[model samples]
Target: MFRILAIAALLSLPATAYAEKLANKLLGAKEVASQQAPMPIGSYAKGCGAGLVELPETGPSWQAMRLSRNRNWGHPEMINFLVDLSQTAQRLGWAGLYVGDISQPRGGPMTSGHASHQIGLDADIWQLPPKRVNLSRAEREKLSSIPVRSADQKSVTRNWTRTHHELMKAAALDPRVDRIFVAAAVKIEMCKTAKSSDKKWLQKIRPIQGHDSHFHVRLKCPAGARLCQTQKPSVNELSKGGDGCDDTLMWWVTDYLNPPKPTKKPKEPAKRTRHPREYTMADLPKQCLDVLASP
Candidate 1:
């Protein structure tokens, strides 16, 4: 009887320890990756990663900005992609690439800044073509990425150049990349400037808010990552297979900045949008508990 009771208590330990604590706090406090085989354990916005590898703070063709955050960790695939992309940047007439946040040591809900990037597959690449890749830690933090989109968010600024266009093209063309997010204006500009024959890759360039200074790249679940959830294809992605230029301005801007009001209140209260900051272990994938507990 005593042995049975002990087993029950042991089974209950994880719940008692994790159920109430904020997942972000638990995850954000981790300063190193879990010791396990590399696996992205959940969806882009609702999961964590194990066995994350750190992108070297400074590489021959890339300098990771924001070292203080210690968010340069990612799955092995992402690390490789960034290195390859930075080399591609050199061919586009830039010295290299200035990479921004990738993911925390143990990818999970961040304490601040992003709602996505909970998984290690999503990364932010600054639009600023690196003039030099050997920036000191202090200079990396002090420097700011230039905005390619205008203040009104209606058009691309003078900073938007042919190199920027080609760089995005190269990324979109990458088979590993699922989608790339940029400001609506930048998408519009790319649509206009791209040659008619070159529109095939443009389908991967998605438009989202607050990406004027940096384009966010989200890679597909690495092959054979069974626990990783693939995002559902939107209606446009299924039907059109076209460059996202048409209706981008209207669909993204108007709806984002000034959303349409509900026609009438329903009997039930609307379901609230769940933010990652508020998540606990109970809200995350079950495996994330093991991830947190792993050495």
Candidate 2:
């Protein structure tokens, strides 16, 4: 009876615990090229990259931040897109770009910060343009990105600028960019200020949470990446049409910004006993293990 009870208790433990253990083993590895052909496997949020390349720390029109994180890796297509985008931004009269996290060496669930960016197709571009191209590693760590949203989060703050809008428009118009995520306030401001012709590209600029300091750019699946997975179609595919400045935009300002007070005192929330879901070897493509094991 004692032996049976002990076995049952062990079986009841959350599967995520085991998944995290295996995931840790892979996450600890340094970025390396896989012996296999360069291919992005699975979806952006739940996938991995096989033959990844590192973005140079500094380029003519951009500087990559957070050097210590070793996250400046991506598929070749993504890296090329970023290089072009930075040059375009500089041509548009903005200062050089300040690039942020791209993806881990062997893309998968990261140790912290972000649920997507697992396929080397998503990147974070800092709101503050780079002051200089030759930023030392120490300066990159200390430099802070300015916030564009107001304190109440209902409107654009004083820090917001027309150049910011121009920068986003440039990214949105790029054929390579599938979509860009920004703060809801930033979207609202764009709607009010964008010219009629510029409004067309606004469809690709999506509003999401916590993008006040930077914008996220995701690319469509690259050609020849047969194993790459695409996200399920959203009810309203932004690329097709719809400026997205309708009731959906209002919800962020009204309902999301200020919720009604509770009628009665709420009970204390229960403590979370279960571990949060962490991606494991099972969650990624089978090829990912080989990618991690590669040279």
Candidate 3:
């Protein structure tokens, strides 16, 4: 009993130490400012300079890590971005948003995008009610479909909505958000709602591909964090008003869920039939003797 107690005490110390380090990293984070009321997606600090924080290093663990695709937390930039989001939610009279996962240390050893989440700073946000919240299935679904405004005050609803547009508009008011990965239609609606002042802010955001399965919020890293990695915006990255988000749901439904189209085979040419010859006996020659014997 004494030995067990001693081991438990020792284990608790490190956990406490780890928690403190993480709190410090998050507490001191800062956000970039947007001059416009409804800032554009990229108007907020982007890439690696948005005061993003990371989960602290507490050494190694012996437990096995699990892997799953669509279960990755992007980077430190995401942390700072969420902080701003949570605060914005609170300021708008809504309950603070829950951050589901961050900094998958095992990379996707047990999950997908291990390379992206390798750093101790990235995380995932979900509309799923926090386990403590105990929301019913219907309630959860409703939460997931709540439509929130994009920063442009446009009625852009994410793939997963979680409340009113005011909640999203309030979150966008922050300056730490770098960009948002939303549904194509949502992006289009947002661009339309953008006011002249909001346009200045909206122009900075670059919308990329994403699923309605979940809303991905990425942020720039905070100052002085070396572990934070930078994601280069893709060449295909584009803003609103260009081919209208260029969405391709066709591949999603056909290639992933629908059966592949069958390939057609070429038909073989038919063999031509020849008319029986009247002088077949002469044509048979020596072979005719063998045929006659067989008969």
Please name the candidate that would achieve the greatest lDDT relative to the true structure. Answer: 1
Across 27-93, the per-residue lDDT of candidate 2 in tens digits comes to: 5365565555778888887777888888999999998899888889888998998999898888877
Q: What would the C-alpha RMSD of candidate 1 be, to one decimal place? A: 3.9
Candidate 1 lDDT by residue in tens digits, 137-209 = 9999899999998898888999999999989899999999999999988888888888887787888899888
Candidate 1: pairs in clash: none
Best by TM-score: 1
Ranking by TM-score: 1, 2, 3
For model 2, which pairs clash? none
lDDT of residue 198 for candidate 1: 70
Residues 1-295 of candidate 3 have per-residue lDDT tens digits of: 5534643543355654633332112211211211111111111111111212332211111001112222222344554456566556555554555444443222211222322222223344443323233344344334432333343322343533434234445444556544455544445555555453544343323344442333455444445544344456544344433222233233323443364875878568788652221112222222211211220
Taking all chains together, each candidate's TM-score versus the true structure is: 0.90, 0.85, 0.41
Candidate 1 ranges with C-alpha deviation above 4 Å: 1-17, 249-269
Clashes of each: 0, 0, 21
Score each candidate by Cα lDDT. Answer: 0.88, 0.79, 0.35
